[model samples]
Target: MKERNHTTLTEFILLGFGSGLGLKEGPFVVFLVIYMTTTLGNTTMVFLISANSPLHISMYFFLMNLSFLDLCYSSTIAPKAMMSFLAGSKSISFHGCATQLFFFGLFASTEAFILAAMAYDRYTAICNPLLYPITMSKQVCIQLLVGSYVCGGVNSMVQTVFTFTLCFCGSNEIDHFFCDIPPLLSLSCTNTDINVLVLFTLSSLIIVSTSMVILVSYACIISAILRIRSAEGRHRAFSTCTSHMMSVILFYGTLTFIYAQPSSLSAPAQSKMVSVFYTLVIPMLNPLIYSLRNKDVREALGRTISSVFLK
Candidate 1:
């Protein structure tokens, strides 16, 4: 048994999806395409919601924020991953890893809470249409947005501080593409019992609490929808939530599978595959799902394009 000071470690070899898989070069092209689509799609969505007056309500407001987050956090991961591949260098500096982890956690946690807030927005809109405006007011919306970001920032700081504080072995080779808790934990030379505890505990606290909010809100919403007498009314009511539900399933499902389990890093190959889903695929899919499913978004997009062309 031998070791060196974690401080002496200047860089980490990010063996993304292992050494012999040939993932670095082959996936570069695919990830580049996905990253482009994610950027274009989310940017278009944010612009569409902001520029249009009709999409100014609570749901779209949350959606716009979600798009911005997806754009931001996806940029945090994808560009770095692609750059490392392009440079043909697996080494990421200590500060770079810290920065990547911070922004990734910040946006990811914020997006979790934002999804919860969106669920509550849907609940208010569908369950209590009469008081929807009063309940999810502009002031309240701002408060929720600020609260989500703050909570996420706090979580990010905690994870970053604790993670970097740990004594890592001299190997400095991370098993995955990005700097994540589980993979980083695998690098620690010291006992990581407390680290693992904090990781899973915070993960559960954020994921479960937000998930409960989404689940409970949707439950009440379902009850309210059932109470509607007209078939068209029920159908229309459920339609508003369908896109959010899909986003929820995809986003939360992957997150929970990865972070919610403490032993996630144990299965490096599987975790890396799933990481691709949330990191690359989900961001790319969100706007497509929303715009394709929701009539108002499609109509708004159409009108925006038409106005652009007419000028």
Candidate 2:
């Protein structure tokens, strides 16, 4: 019996969804369209938020950050996967894989924090309407935004360093579309108990903490809305939160499913499907949901389009 060399791995072959599902061109077309839509949609969100003065408030400011995060997050995995699907080349250099892993974690974690901030903004706006302007002022919003990115960077650095430090003597074929911590940890030749523990701990802390913030904010918001005597006033107040709540549910639900459990408990195939939803579907849906459901965004979009076309 030959002992496996632990330090010889230089790259990893990502077994993309197409190969995993045994379909080539069909998945490629679907994913390509999804990628394009996500990119365009998120880009438009950023553009509209930045160019329109009416949307310069805290909610849209946080939304712009989210749009930027989604753009980077989807780019971290989607382009590589789409290229793999198109060119039938699934191999990624070790450094490239590590880079992807870092950015993916950074953007994802940052987005979670941003969502929490947005929830707090809503809470202030609805529950403490008189103080909303002071509570979510520009300086405070900037602080929160900066803090989210810093926390994300720290988290990414820790996870990337921990995951890549392990020796990969095992096969280099990752059973997913990207270089995720779980798939990479599964390939490690070293004992992965600490890595698994760290992954679980960090994931739980980020997801649970942010989710709690959102939950508490919404609880306060609901309470405040219930106090209103007029039904129309209550309905209008609740409507202001529906789009954000829907986004939070979709983003956090898929994320919790994918990251909240031990790697041993997750099936790679099922994980990939959930990953598809998280990475591709969510980003594409967020801007659409926010724009279609919110009257302000629609009016802004109409104004922006009219300005461009009329001139």
Best by TM-score: 1
Model 2 clash pairs? none
Once model 1 is optimally superposed onto the true structure by TM-score, how far is the C-alpha of residue 307 displaced, in angstroms? 1.1
TM-score of each: 0.97, 0.95
Task: For candidate 2, report its TM-score.
Answer: 0.95
Q: Candidate 1 versus the native: TM-score?
A: 0.97
Off by more than 4 A, model 2: 1-7, 18-23, 263-265
The global C-alpha lDDT for each of the candidates, from Candidate 1 onward, is: 0.91, 0.89
Kindly report which residue stretches of model 1 are placed more than 4 angstroms away from their true locations once superposed: 1-3, 20-23
